[model samples]
Target chain A: MQFLRTVLTIARKDLVIEARSRELAYTTLFFAISVVLVFSFSFVVEGVALTDAAAGILWVAIAFAGTLALGRTFERERQADTLKALLLSPVERPAIYLGKLVGLLLLMTVVEALIVPVVGLLFQAPLGRAPWLLTGLLAAGTLGFAAVGTLFAAMLIRAHSRDVLLPVVLYPITVPLVIAGVRGTASIFAAEPNLAMAQAWLSMLVFFDAVFLTLALWVFGPVMSE
Target chain B: MVSVDDVSRNYGRRRALARVTLQAARGEVLGLFGPNGAGKSTLISVLSTLLRPSSGRVRYGTHTADGAGDALRGHIGVLGHDLFLYGDLSARENLAFFGRLYGLDDLDARVTDALRLARLSDRADDRAGSFSRGLRQRLALERALLHQPRLVLLDEPFTGLDDDSALVLIERLRSLRERGTIVVMATHDFDTAEAVVDRAICVDRGRAWPVAAGAGTLRERYRRTLKERG
Candidate 1:
């Protein structure tokens, strides 16, 4: 019960800060929109081609924008040495990781909400056919991304070139999630959406999230410890 | 009581703290005076469990840092060089947030007391980003004390304070000592050290030894040590 309270406190703090500033949400949304627009113009050889490429473009945009959000999210903690302060508290380290993961997931979900419709409009992708499945796939893939991303962001918080290093360290480890996300999303955008294939990819994403989240929780204490 | 035993910390080839040992009992204000790069902050970090020593151990009463773990941390309150309050949050929000983290039972009342203690009640609703350096330092100190910790560590607490603000802080330190809170403060300012500290230790080249007299004597000793090391 205390653990859950601590997690909620941390998540609430981040959300409150984000709600007031809206810095990460606004910037990430704008960046995702820009990425989608650029891809639509560059990749659309014809209407059919645009629809086919939509999944890749949408996921890639989320990946790029999600990375930015993760960096900025940790950057707030880094600015006033707030992360160190958080570390000094008696709360469990994994709780901190979980809280950050939830915050990142929420921010990424908002960006995805905005991006999916924009992608649908611009590329003529079939987003309405399988709304629930699409949401599930996005959630699963983003959970994996945030699980690993939060860990690396905390690890590199004090590194000299953290901004440059975050993406470099993050992308390689999360490639499997991205692959699963793109495949799952592609299936959803198909003329007759392959629910089974998307489900398989979704299952893979869930597995990845569970395994990586456990690993992150296990390693957070030692990595964050001085 | 808090005890540091033969603690040594190193970063690569550079040694930050040598096998330094010290002890502080309740109702005492122990001042750590050192020149820059003399490992005062590093030693304080170890005491606060923010840094693990490369060798040696820290004990709070009978329990070691590892053994005590979260319980030990719960009794420690630290105000370091960085103001740990989030700039975007209002002063009241920052204190309330940390009070909840410390699991304080009466969070609203505790936060109110903390705000009054820091003299930040008037500006409690304003964003911390708008606070002056001195106000921020005061707020940080308040945050450290909100949990009613038994052991308080302040690293260069007087760095940015004006004379008036410094006096207000000194009074609070004196009150903490009177209440039997073990206070360890790291600073180079002899005047401030002489004002509040019950005993002083001068550290140089990663080692520490007690100063024989008050701030004036300690100042001379520190210069002599620096000259000898050069």
Candidate 2:
């Protein structure tokens, strides 16, 4: 119960800061929309079919945009060395990771909420057909992405080249989630959506999220300490 | 009581602290004075459990920092060079956030009292980003003391404070000492050290020794120590 309270307190603190600044949400949303628009324009083919292109574009936009959000989120903690202050607190390190993951998830979810419709409108894809499945895939993929992303972001808070290093390190490890997300999203966006294939990809996403989140939780304390 | 036994810390090839031993009892204010790279802040970091000693250990009574882990941190309040308060949050919100993190009961009351203590009650609703450096330092002090920690670590607490504000802070440190809170302050300001410290030590080149007795003043003792070492 105390752990949960700590998690909520941290999450609330991040959310409150974001709410006041509106920096992360606005920047992430704008970046996501921009990515979608650029991709939509580029992926147009005169004769070639664009069946799976929409799924690829949507997931790529989210992945890229999510990185932006993660950077900014950790940037706030880095300012004034607030992350060190948080580390000095009695709260469990896993709780801190979980709290940051939830905050990132929420911010990414808001970006998706805005970007999904834009993707649909621009790509002429039917994202509204299976709203629930799409939500599950997005949630599962984002959880996995954030679980690992938060750890690396914190680990690199003091790194000299953190901005360049974050994506360089993050993208390789998150390949499985991206592959699963793109495949699952492509399956859902199929003319006659393949439920079984989508479910399989979703399962892969869920498994990766669980394994990485537990690993992240276990390593956070030691990695964060001197 | 807090006991640091031969604590030494290093970063890469540079040694920050070397075989430094110190102790502070309840109701005592221990001042650590040193030159720019003298490792006073390093020792404070070790005591605060933010940095682990490369060799040796620190003990709070019978429990070591390794054994106590997060629980040890609960009893510590640190005001380092970094303010630690979020600039976007109002002063009240920053206090309330830290109050909840410390799991204090009746949080609203505690936050109210903290704001009043920092003399920031009038500007409690304003964002910390808008405050002057002295005001920010005051609010940071309030945040550190929100839970009434047993051990308070202040690193250059007077960095941005005006003379009047510094005196106000000194009085507060005295009050904490009277309340049996152990205070360890690291600063270059010898005057503040002379004003409040029960005992002062001059640390140089990673080693520490007590400021000599019968010395003219902290400033004189410190200069003499540095000259002798040279």
Candidate 3:
């Protein structure tokens, strides 16, 4: 019970800061929209998007924007050494990690809510097709991506040139997540929609989320100790 | 009681703290005096368990850091150079947030008392970023003490404070000492520290030496002691 309260407290603190500064929201959202627009030009040839390009473009925007959000979130903590303060507090490290993960999930949900519709409008994809499966895949995939991202971002708080290092270290590790998200999203939005294939990919994403979340929770304590 | 036994810390080939040993009983204030690279901050970090001694151990009562873990940290409040404050949050919100993090009871009353201690009651709703450095430092001190930790480790608490603000801090430290909280402070501000520090030790080249009596002043002792040690 105390652990849960601690987690919520941390998340609430982040949200309050973000709500006031709007740094992450403004920058990440603008960057995400820019990514979608730039891709629309390349992927949509003369007003018609390539058959399978929207899924790739949509996932790419999310991946890039998620990285930006992850970097910025930890950057706030690093700016004033607040992360050290949080670490110094007498709470379970996993609770801290879960709190950060939950906050990121919510922020990313907002970004996707805005970006997904924009992607659909621009690329002429049917976003409403198999909505529940799409939501599951999005949730599981975001969880997997954010779980690994939060751990890495926290670990890199003291490292030099962390901005450049974040993407360099993050992209390679998140390959499976992006791939599953893209394929799952692709199958659901395919010309002749493959709901079964989407379900299979969603299952794979769920498995990935569970694995990543567990590993991240276990690793956070020792890694953050120093 | 806090005991640090022959603690030595090294970063790569650079020795930061060399076989340093010290102990402070409850209600005592130990001042660490040093020049730029004398390892005062390093010693404080070791005491706070933020960094491990490359070769020694610290014990809080009967328990080591490994055994106590979060329980050990629960009783330690640190005010490092970083301040550990969110510039975007209001003074009241900052205190409230840390209060919740520590799971303190009657959070509103505690936060109100803390805000009063910081003397920011009038500006409680003001963002910390907009406050002057002295104001931030005071708020940070109160933030560290919000949990009422048994051991308070302060790294240069007097930095960036004006005379009046420093006096407020000195008075607060005196009260903390009266409350039987063990405070270990690392500061170059000998005059201000002299007002509150019960015992003073000079650390030079990563080695610690207790300042003897018959001193001209802490600054004089610090200079003469380092020269003699050299």
Candidate 4:
């Protein structure tokens, strides 16, 4: 119950703020649209190239937009020095991580929803068999990215070149998720649509999400407090 | 009661607070007097369970401050120079938000009471980002009081307040003390310390001087010691 309250409060505050500003949603959607538009114009969408390249382009959009959202998750709090207040509360650190994860998931899902239709219309690519499989993978991938990004973003905010440093630090560690996400998308988009192959990527996503989230929670309190 | 024994902290080669010891009973408001870099913030951070000491220990009731000091933190409230209130949230929303974190019952009622004490009930719906320095300080105080904590560690709580706000805060501190809450405030201001805190300790070069009974107030003693030490 304590953990749930912590998650809810943090997530609620973040979502409320995002709702008011609409920056997270707006930026994420714009970025996703630009990614699809740029790819659509750059590649010939009339032939097999459109179908063959859809999964890679889709994962790239998710990864890139996910990074943008997670990067700003704690910027306002850190800037206004409110993170100290949050830390001072009795809620454990892991709860803070989970709360941020949920907020990021919500925003990332919104961006994904926008991108799915855009991808479908622009690329003439179908979501294919196991559509929910695609959503599940996207959710897991977003969770992994958000967990690692939130932790690193907190650290980056303390450094000299935070904006430049955030992506440099984040993108490298999150490569596994990007790879798994693409492979997961590819499995669903493939002709055979093999369950075992899709499950493997999904399993990696889940495992990565669990591992990074636990570690991020363990390290977040000390880093943010400092 | 809270006790600190030989607590010290270091960052690489720079030692912040070195082997400082302090003790305060319930209801006693202790003022820590120090200039910049006197390790006042570091000491407060360690006691408030925000930072771990490189050496020594702190005790709150039966709990040790090293590993499980978090249990002690639950019973304490901290208001640092950093307002620590979310700027986007309204004054009441900020209070309500923190009140829930501390699991306060009737969170809205608690927020209402806090805003009243902070004299911000009229501006409860105003974003904290729009507040003046004095108003922000007042709101931060309200945030600290939302949980009705038994212990409070304040770092420079009087920095940005006007005379009226200062007086209001002193009155609030006195009431908290009357209710048996231990308040530890670190400040560079003697007049404010003289008005609010009962016992005062001078922190210099990372060591806390032994508090002694003297004529005048704790602030007077603190100024005299700084001069004498110099």
Candidate 5:
């Protein structure tokens, strides 16, 4: 109960601050929309959209926007120099990691909510076909991304070139999750809609989430200790 | 009681602290007087367990940092050069956030009391970013003490404060000492620090030199230590 309370408190604090500043929200959403617009040129092919480009564009938007959110999340802590205070708090390190992951996931979810429909509209993909499956894929993929992202951002909070360093470190590590996400969504968005293949990819994503979350939780404590 | 036994910390090739030892008792305010890069902040970090000493150890009573774990951290309150208060959050919100992290049960009452201690009850609803340096410093100090830590570590608590703000801080330190809280402060400011420091140690060039009474004023003693020990 105590551990969970600590996690929720951290999430609530981040939410309250973000609510006031709107720093991450505005920056992430704008960047994501811009990404979709820029990529639309390549995938749209003059006037007609590519048949299977929506999945790739959607994940690309998410990954780019997620990276932005992850960077800013810890930047807030570093800006106020409050990261040490959070560390100095009596709560467990995993609770801190989990709280940050939860906040990032929430922010990414909002960005995705905006971008998914935008990608569907622009790319002419069938977003309404598998609403439940699409939500699951997004949730699992986001969890996998944020689980590792939160840990890395926290570790790099004090680095001199953290802004450049974050995505460089984060992207290579999260490629496997992104591949699974892209493949799963691609199957669902396909003309025939391969439900079985999509399910398999979703299962793979869940497995990836468990592994990344466990590794991040295990690694967060020791990494932050130094 | 806090005891640091011959602790040395290094950042790769550069040695930040070298074979230094110190002690502070309950109800005492120990001052670490030093110039910039003299390793006073490094010593404070080692004592706070924010940095691990390459050699030696620090203890709070019978428990070592590793042995006591989070419990040791729980009893420690640190006010670093940075206030660590979120600017977007209101003063009350900042206190409430940290208070929750410390798991204080009577949160509302504690937040109210801390705001009062900070003399920020009037501006409690204002954003911390809008606060003056003194106001933020006062709020930060109260935030650190919100949990009533057994040992308080402060790195330049009087850095940017007016006379009135400095007096409030001095009074608060005296009150903490009276309540038997062990307070350790690192500062270059001698005039203000001299008012509360029960014991003084002059740190220079990553080494700890015990302050021996030299002439008058902490400035004189500090200068004497540097000139004699250098």
Candidate 6:
């Protein structure tokens, strides 16, 4: 209960702050759209091939855009020097990590929603049999992404080269989750509807979420406290 | 209520604090006055369980500092220069956020009481980002007190406040002391120190010197002591 309370409070606060800024959310949305548009131009758009590639395109968009959004997750905290205050609080450190993770999850969800229609429009993809299932897989992969992303964001902010360092550190570490996420996404698009493949990817994502989030929680207090 | 013996912290070969020992009882305000880079904040960071001591030991209440820092955190609150507040959050939102962080059961009531105590009930809905320096400081005080912590560690709590705001804060700190909250505030401001704290300790080069010989003669003597130590 104590852990949940702290995490919820942090997530709520971040949401409120993001709502007030509007630009932070808008920035990620714009970035997501831009990535899709650029992909549309770069890849062949006139053929049925583009339609078949819709799931891959959407996952790629989310992954790239999420990387951008996650980097800015700690921007306001660092700018206002408010991290010190939060660290000094009696609340558990893992609570802060979970809170930030949830907050990022909320932001990424909004980005995902905006990209879904764009992906359909750009590629003219057919409506898949299990849209909700695809969304569930996306959320699971994102949970794992955000868990690790939050911890790295805190570390990246302190480095002398934040912009270059974040993606460099994040993408390589998150390869398996991304692959699982992309595969899980692809299965829904495939006419065969292989539950086994989707389940395998989803399970992999859940395992990654559990491990990375636990590690992030364990180290986040010591990291943020510094 | 708080005790530290031979406590030290270092990063690589750079020592932040070294072989420091101190103790404070309930209802006592232990002032940690030091110039910049004297390890005052570092020591407070260790005590607050934010930083681990490289060696030695610290104890707060029943928890030893080395292993059970989180256990100690429940009994401690801190007010540093960093308000750690969300700029877009209103006073009430800010207080409620922190209140929830502490897992307070009656969150709304606690937030209301904290707002009133900080004299911010009227502006409870104002965004903290737009607040003046003084108002923000007031809100920061409210944030520190939301958890009803037994010990409060304040780092430069009076830095940017005006005379009136500073006085109000001093009164609030005095009241907390009266309520038996052990406060250890760090500052270089002698006037505010004299105006508020019951006792002062001058910290220099990772060491602490209590001003016990003549508490009234602190302002002059504390200054001289720092100069000599430096």
Per-prediction DockQ, in order? 0.89, 0.88, 0.84, 0.64, 0.84, 0.60
**Every model's TM-score:** 0.97, 0.98, 0.98, 0.93, 0.98, 0.91
lDDT per residue (tens digit) for residues B95-151 in model 2:
888888788899999999988988998999999999999999999998998888999
lDDT of each: 0.90, 0.90, 0.92, 0.83, 0.90, 0.80
Q: Clashing residue pairs, candidate 3?
A: none
Q: Where does candidate 5 clash, by residue pair?
A: none
lDDT of 4 by residue, A58-120 (tens): 888887887788667767777766777777788887787778778888888889888988876
- Please say which candidate is ahead in TM-score: 5 or 6: 5
For A1-226, candidate 6 gives per-residue lDDT tens digits of 8778778888888887888888668888998899888878866545444434767778777878888887777877786666666766667778888888889999999988888888777776544667767777888888888887789988777677887888888888888888888788777667566767887788888899889888888998767766
Q: On a 0 to 100 scale, what is the lDDT of residue A121 in model 6?
A: 71
Tens-digit lDDT track for model 3 on B90-171? 9999999988888899999999999999999999999999998889999999999999999999999999999999999999
Report lDDT (Cα) of residue B228, candidate 5: 90
Model 2 agreement with the true structure over A75-130: per-residue lDDT tens digits: 99999899888888898989888888888988898889899898888877788878
Q: Write the per-residue lDDT of candidate 1 for residues A56-104, one digit (tens) a residue.
A: 9988998999999999999999999999999999988898888888888
Kindly report which residue stretches of model 5 are placed more than 4 angstroms away from their true locations once superposed: none
Which of the two candidates, 1 or 3, achieves a greater TM-score against the reference? 3
- Candidate 4 lDDT over residue span B85-152, tens digit each: 77778998888888878887887777888889999889999998899988999989878877888889
What CAPRI-style quality would you assign to candidate 1?
Answer: high
Relative to the unseen true structure, what is the C-alpha lDDT of residue B183 in candidate 3, on a scale of 0 to 100? 98
The candidate that achieves the highest lDDT relative to the unseen native structure: 3
Q: Which ten residues in a row have the lowest lDDT in candidate 3 chain A?
A: A43-52
Give, for candidate 2 chain A, the lowest lDDT window spanning 10 residues.
Answer: A40-49
Q: For each candidate, how many residue pairs have backbone atoms clashing (under 3 Å)? A: 0, 0, 0, 0, 0, 0
- For candidate 6, give the lDDT of residue B229: 65
* Tens digits of lDDT, candidate 3, A1-226: 9999998988888898889888898888999999999989888988888987999988998999999999999999998899999889989999999999888888999999999999999999898888888889889999999999999999999999999999999899899999999999999888899999999999999998989999999999999887
